[model samples]
Target chain A: MSYRKAYLAAPLAALLPVQAAAQGIDETINTIFADYTGWYVSLIFADLPGTNFSWIALWLVVAALVFTFYFGAIQLRGFTHSIALVKGDYSDPDDAGEVSHFQALATALSGTVGLGNIAGVAVAVGIGGPGATFWMIVAGLFGMATKFTECTLGVKYRNEYPDGRVSGGPMYYMTKGFSERGLPGGKIFAILFCIFTILGALGGGNMFQANQAHAQLSGVLGEYPGWITGLLLAGVTFIVIVGGIKSIAQVTEKVVPFMGIFYVIVSVIILLMNFDMIGWAFGQIFMGAFTGLGVLGGFTGALIQGFRRAAFSNEAGIGSAAIAHSAVRTKEPVTEGYVALLEPFIDTVVICTMTALVIVITGVLNIDPETGLYVWNSEAGRISTEGEVAGVELTSAAYARAFSWFPAMLAIAVVLFAFSTMISWSYYGLKAWTYLLGEGAAKETTFKVIFCLFIIIGASANLGPVIDFSDAMLFSMAVVNVIALYFLMPIVKRELESYVSRLRSGEIKRFKS
Target chain B: MSSEVFVVAYEGAQDDPGVLGYAMQRAAVEGATLLLVHVLEWSPYSFLTPEELEERHGRRAKEIERARSDVTGPALDKVKAAGIEAECVIRYGNVVELVVEEAGKAGAGMIFVGRSGSQSVAARVFGSVPMGLAQISPVPLVIVP
Candidate 1:
């Protein structure tokens, strides 16, 4: 039987009642089983065909190139400036806004740096082989332009409520930017963008984060029920989120740096242990990126997968990070824009490269002697057909192989990393929900509770479909957000010029003291 | 009866000192007492060493007193030049809480704050601390951009 037919038939046949079973038994069995099966079937079927994106990746490559050129290669030109912002060279207490430049960068990074870096990179390497890492770095480099444009617009169009609060993101740019440009459908597009953003938050920012955390917890603490893990995560997340951005920032400012440093240090140690294979791994990455193994499909597939994972990881084009960047304290929006360009670099280029290197350097993708195709033994704790590995298990394996008895330590790191990410994303999703639902206490409470509940749901329930749907929602948001950004480019240019003028005129002097 | 007004500037405003002058002028015109308050939002780590904390606090106190002297000196000069009475008050806490408390302690009828320019209304509403205080402040708050 065909895959689809067999998939449908098995579920239907399982629902068929035994001859001895009563009508009540049939009803109870069907009701309980039907809902789950239906959800699963839909999830598997809903997988989009073109999502693999063989040709679109090339288009993305072209767009990245054009954006870099049009922006005067802001990524390279402003690299020093980006570093300065992080180092607090220009921070001024007199600056009007919310958080510091560093805090704003951390907040935005907290949103972008999550499971997409971990699981998504693993999937790419699994399907496309090690070569995908090279294209990923390429995509990450070009993505800085996209990041700059969206963030510049985010600040330019941000709304300061009469109450002195700031609300900015694609929602503002979509409406105000387009209206200024005389677009007929500005409000409609803005409303649609808000809706998609809210959906994306629920799916990508909330559910997916919970799902991954749940997976990791389940993997490490298999004895504990998944629902319990979800409950614990939900409780901790609620405390941080209820305090809003200030609290979120405080937590992430500490958590992100620690986790980022911790992950990098561990990856470096692992790489050092396998010092000999480093050269070979780099060689494979370069060769596999361009040359298909006896076919065009492999080469292109690797390229697409690499780009896809990198795009998803850094979120340079997605515009969600802009919402966070818009909160930065600065009279000059372009200052924050420059700060934002560093996000893709840290998230995709630095952290993700480390993860990719660990996986590839470990020889996780060994060539089968019989098939001559790269495959891992399912029993050997490698990438399975089901794509299930203990959260950080493969990385842990590599580390453990290098330094015996390190899996436990690595497990602790994984849990902490996942925990920090979940808490950060909860804030992002909550803000998006607040944008949609308004700031009513009832609405805020309901969204927070529901969001917390999802952590439990994500932990206990099988989240394969839920995460897939969330991933789609996140990328779909990028589609709408990036389009809005194109229309708002003029505002970005205006802001940049105005800020640069002020800088040159010394109206806004660097904080020398 | 004229109402009192207090203007507080954080760390970065010390350079211009014009904001202090401006606050004094507004107070003199209204026959209100001008209190210039500067707050130090120091980190918790600063308290780890008692000696360090004392030294830091001493330096911070000196800075506040200097800023207070500068404000009241020029402010009183301007007030006396215009034939008005003015005073300067200095204290510290959380920025928002300190401002609110000092506004009450000084019994100022109104408060004036500098505005960070060129932001949309929504950005201010969701993210700005001044905006948040304005929403719920017991007294009228003026944002000077």
Candidate 2:
């Protein structure tokens, strides 16, 4: 990487000191980002004493489990109805929510279904081996309950302005739901959630997206000054974000879903092409989940990686989906919950599993012949994947094995995924920002300008600290959001019970059979 | 018992008033009740951001109101003045699809659609609402000049 930089960066250095100055700033930002964010990161992701399990992960899992039982497994019971809702089958003209089920689902899926499904899955499989796929699926299934619970509360407590604007999220529910129940501390938790969401929008949603888009672009275009990519991305994003192009959102709402379907179709084609290996691949996945398949720690290692990546990819318990789902048009808030539950399932259970199966079936992870363990890349200090690649590159390489031209397609998909995610997060971050700073044109523009600048920073800077800080902030959102969920879930339960009874008794009007 | 219905697909652009006027005359002659169906041009499948989705219900309602009051209301009044009972319908969806659907629902005998002025490349390739109606409307579709 350094040699490529030296070779590619010579002209920019000789022409001017601009690139040099950017590098210096990158180092300073990285250091400061790491220093200030390290403690918070460790605190959220820390392993429980004498166990590899993280309290954060456990908190999310237990909440999902409890919600699953409390609502009598609403995820399973309402799964078909959720599909029906999205298809406009049960949609009533008088019961319009803000957005359609499809739009709300698309918006939330765009946020969760980005590089994490591609890159994060690769990393999990690299470290935990094939067994991780099984656990990831399990985690994603339970996560549906979590998404259902929180989004129901989101709509129940959402603030709809008379002018037709709507703002509802974890922050609103945290305060409003708690206050309604006569509980204190909702104010503080809500405030903390907003803070985390703002920082998270900057780091995970904006910068990380910019950063990976840069990496993919540079890989395809040959090593170029990162700032060039950053500037181009930032400029385009500013036009779309600040310019308020409703058409772009419409285009993405169409395109992102198209891309997702395309990705899965290709995955299906690859699996069919290697038709004989499908069963064996499932065997490896199932066996690995329990026995750990000679990977470092066995069952526990696979379980941890599966849970962590599923959480990262689907964000079921994070409460961010509530923000997106709350915007859905539904008279019954629980109907949105039914719709929101499909997000984690689509993201983790379906998409992530496709990437995982492709990696395992394509024989991407290098295995030690004698020990049958995943080979560690001593130089890269990670598990050696096919062609000694890792992260998103490994997923790309695995797909390339089926179609040599797939890497280029994957690159395009990555950038589109990043772009859609950034736009969505800009909204998420803006909502939080306006909540804290108050609504005004100047305030909104200020946050937007800063967001666009961070896009450039994310694209231009080294990923080490930027990604680290963002991932931490993103998880930190979960820390506050989950606490709110615990308190607010009963509210969701009441909604679910009423909605279900009405639905069964033919009280909830269905416009379509 | 002269309660026959005539469906007029109203775009309400420059050429639309002329087409609607013709429909009103035809309805008056036939003693048919006029059903002015104005479609707001919406696709249910289009994706929306959080902000867009949040304001969608309000925007859609506003769109419906504007189409009804501003576009169809005057036409309906003019037709009523011409001794033809008229009702206005505002809907959201493809112009051709909604026109046909509303026509069937209202039991209209004929449909009138205006030829939009701009015949740009996109309009040519995608086909105009009148062109679509010519291909698909169950009732007789008249393309007004």
Docking class of 1: incorrect
What stretches of model 2 exceed 4 Å from their correct place? A1-25, A94-98, A243-250, A378-381, A460-464, B14-18, B114-145
Tens-place lDDT digits, model 2, residues B1-145: 2598888887775544688888877887887888888877666567776677778878877877877778777777777777888888777667788789888888889998887755699889998888889999998988888
What's the true lDDT of residue B55 in model 2? 83
lDDT of 2 by residue, A1-513 (tens): 456546765655563557677667667766776787778778877889998787776877787788788888888888999999898887654343236788788878988898889877987898788888898999999999989888889888999888877889998998899999899999899888889899899988888888778777666555666677778878878888898766776677668778989999999999999999999999989999999887777888888788878887898887788998887777889888998999989999999999999999999888789987677665765567766766677888899899987877888899889888888888999999998889999999999999999887787667666656776788788888887888777788778778888988989877888
Candidate 1, backbone clash total = 28
Q: What is the C-alpha lDDT profile of model 1 across A1-513, one tens digit per residue?
A: 445435534543443453234334334433553465455335423423665444335545665676688778989988998888777778763431235667677767766776777766776676666778888999999999888888888877887654345667777788888888888777777667777666676666766666666565444444234555666777777776654434443544566566767778978998988899899889878887886332225677678778877887887777787777776557778888898999999998998888889887776555656854556434632333223443345555555556655655554555555566555455555556777667788887787777777666655544445545665556667667766766777777777777777878988777743
Q: What is candidate 2's CAPRI-style docking category based on DockQ?
A: medium
Candidate 2 overall lDDT versus native: 0.82
The alpha-carbon lDDT assigned to residue B97 of candidate 1 equals 64
Candidate 2, TM-score vs. the true structure? 0.92
